[model samples]
Target: MSDEPLSIDSTSNEYLINADELSTVQYINSTSQDKVLVDIGFYTATKKDLECLLNSEMFLNDSVMNAYIRILKAQPSINEREDGYAYLETTYNANMICGDTITSLRNKEEGNFRLYRTSTYLNNDMVFFPINIKDCHWYLVVINGRKGVVQVLDSKGTATRRPQLHQLVIH
Candidate 1:
């Protein structure tokens, strides 16, 4: 509801790098793609991935988005908030839900790989899915689990995938 920034790291930049992390960011920027800049949980950011954050024109990459989600999930304030919020990784929404049709997403075969089930999130008042659509755009799919409402917050107002996204969220 608020545009207020989350101080997950320290920097106000989308890259979310603090003064301490500037050196690491610089190293990653200077090095080749093979270099591992930051490893936050399952997501890894390399030189190529860091570019997405450093360069605002570039679309936000899955690794960067997921890494930030992981960081947000780890924040004490987010976890302690009255409105319990849960976060699903970019992989979950992009690959598992959005990538497949509602029919396939409903299939029980992929249940074992569901990250949401294994994640350490509190009760889902608001479930956030930071999605990378077709690797060209990034938007948020916020599910109000308590209120049974699904909201799409896309800056560009791309409604092409709304129907599919709704089906995926429900099923």
Candidate 2:
């Protein structure tokens, strides 16, 4: 948050320094509603570190999103960052079967939701469906074709998901 000389802790083993990605950012706070970032100092970080530091709003290019893709692809078990979820959805929309199918669906009455239907439904051994609801959100719906059970996974507990569950289907 400081605009002065930048500093980095040399003791942290989780972070590795890469001089190329180390750079400063500056901007003008034209709005009175929210406190804006006027400047940020430089600090050395690896590609992964830079990706972690960058937020959804700072996802200004493919490099940042690609970094996240590498992380998700490298390890699917990890809970994606909220910003990572944005990029995850983007890549998922482009490459995943659910992206090509009907992701936005309506109830029997008159409503719209994210409980999507995918081509992989009941066709593949494993399927992952992503859903985000208002107020609270679930990350993915894991359907185990072999087990014949559909499970919904979420890092954050849902308050409104119970109602949406009925409209959701694994196949």
Candidate with top lDDT is 1
- Looking at model 2, residue 104 earns an lDDT score of 37
TM-score list, all predictions: 0.68, 0.36
Q: Count clashes in each candidate, considering only residues at least 3 apart in sequence or on different chains.
A: 0, 0
lDDT at 157, model 2? 49
The RMSD of every model to the true structure, in order and in angstroms, is: 8.3, 11.5
Tell me the tens digit of each residue's lDDT in model 2 across 76-135. 454343322212333233223333233433335213223343332433555554553422
Q: Write the per-residue lDDT of candidate 1 for residues 44-121, one digit (tens) a residue.
A: 877777676655457777777778778876887764457665555455555556665535645685565455543432
Error of 2 at 127 (Å): 1.0
Candidate 2, RMSD to the unseen true structure? 11.5
In candidate 2, list every pair of residues with a backbone clash. none
